[model samples]
Target: MGQKSLVSTWHYLVALAAFLLSYFAGLPMPWIIVGVIAVGLLRYAILSKTSKIDAIPGPLVIVLAYVGFMAGFNHFHQSYSMAAIGLITTAYFTFLPNFALIFVGAPLIERTQKNTCIQFILSLVTASVVGVIVNLACYLGIGILFPSGVSSWYAIEPMALVWVLFSLFLLFKYKIGMLKLILLSLAYGFLLFLWRLNKMPMG
Candidate 1:
């Protein structure tokens, strides 16, 4: 219908404007949400007679994928020596919104499921983000336990290797939560600490 297409166009325009504003701003990205509210109160709610700003989360997911990819690339490619806790923090900021939306904004997406293009984009973003999280987790875990750097074939020790396997298992089997990921990372760090203490030539 003409009316449905018009509504979709409006959503895209608002999403694009907010996305660009946030990217160019010096402050954090959530300031984009504030800008959307201001515009909604003035132009959308009054001048344009648009009753509400329907947030099309497709754009948000796209941003998350980019941030996750950049974070993973930077953390790994820098000699792969970043702290596990540091990388976990980055994952939090990247995934938190998607986590929240799984309950709140998900229903809205289902309700307005007419746009096949949006649905296709959303599916790709979801799959890409999952891959990013898994890959980043593996790198951070390995880097934490192997500060000297891993081989091209990755000849990690047995105990540290188990932690790596467990991380992947949690990711694939149990829908790994944020707390579990952080705790597992800490466990890896602690185990590495014990290994160093044992390697001090036994006094």
Candidate 2:
């Protein structure tokens, strides 16, 4: 395989491994350490081989940095524990799929198309919609089942909104077809319902 393809494959593998680790470990020490190491390796390998750093959007970088800083600030005031470190480490896993989809998968989709730019935009929007649906389902199910315990729905809302709006913007910018527009609208409606049910704001 070519260098790019190799790098993409490695990224997918790393994402899958981190996801599995997070799923089984439930924000514990070993899993957190594994996730951090996996992310570090993925970033380093991509940078070294492709000379392409993950071009995270400026807004996302700022938000993540702020979150990290705040978390660190909290740690400074309070005693930092393994549990806190693990939670923060696990939270980083959330971005892997988003980054992999847009950077690794979307480029391949673009390359395979005659109208690469248009296809890339469409693929990205579709993936974002799917991601939103999956996350919504996850959070809603947890809320319903637990009813009173700690829930992830509120925590993930901002990131989900960002992806949804970004996807919508891409759709408008690319002038996606009416069929896709309708489908995306329905997906958004479902998302709204879930948000309301979970007592989370749409944006």
Candidate 3:
């Protein structure tokens, strides 16, 4: 591991660059997407004769840990108790599926590493899956912290239950087009917000 680490020193540099670019771009959770694209470009398009992107040692994890910290603070720090962060983060077991998807996607990526455009496509998919994972964690964390309000919808509404089940099936069983799924979630979140606003009695 140590020997391999020395040769892959450029990995974190690319990661840092990705984070800065994400910050400037104002994209939510941009680090993973940027890092993935950078590594792909380096391996397939830029340095194809010299190196491969797989050497980057999964830079997504750096973004993952950063997101976790923010999740810890946003979800837990402002809650009834700070200690709930540990329990909520732990109880959700949200990272399990994300890590599982990463492992599952690893072997599949070998088939497309040689193509420049295809590599970025794969990177986008990877970032999308990570986004879903992190979103799931935060979602479950909210429920854990506020059970009555956050988790009760599924029980009262059959459509909600069906949608939740279908979403899980799509995310875990199916492996392609994750970016679409992320967009779907974003749209759903917006509609949910609007629905809540509509419920408010205005003066």
Q: How far is candidate 3 from the true structure (C-alpha RMSD, Å)?
A: 17.4
TM-score-superior candidate, 1 or 2: 1
- Report, for all candidates in order, the number of backbone clashes: 0, 0, 0
At residue 144, give the lDDT of candidate 1. 46
Task: Sort the predicted structures by lDDT, highest score first.
Answer: 1, 3, 2
Off by over 4 Å in 3: 1-146, 149-160, 172-174
State each model's CA lDDT, in order. 0.46, 0.44, 0.45
What are the RMSD figures for all models against the true structure?
Answer: 17.4, 16.1, 17.4
The sequence of per-residue lDDT tens digits that candidate 2 reaches over residues 61-149 is 23233333333334335434632542364346446654555565666655667886777786775666466445544544343334454
TM-score of each: 0.35, 0.23, 0.29
lDDT, residue 63, candidate 1: 38
Give the per-residue lDDT of model 3 (tens digit) for 26-142. 222344334333334233222221122222222444443433333233434344343344234322333454455556766765766798998778578667657754654554434
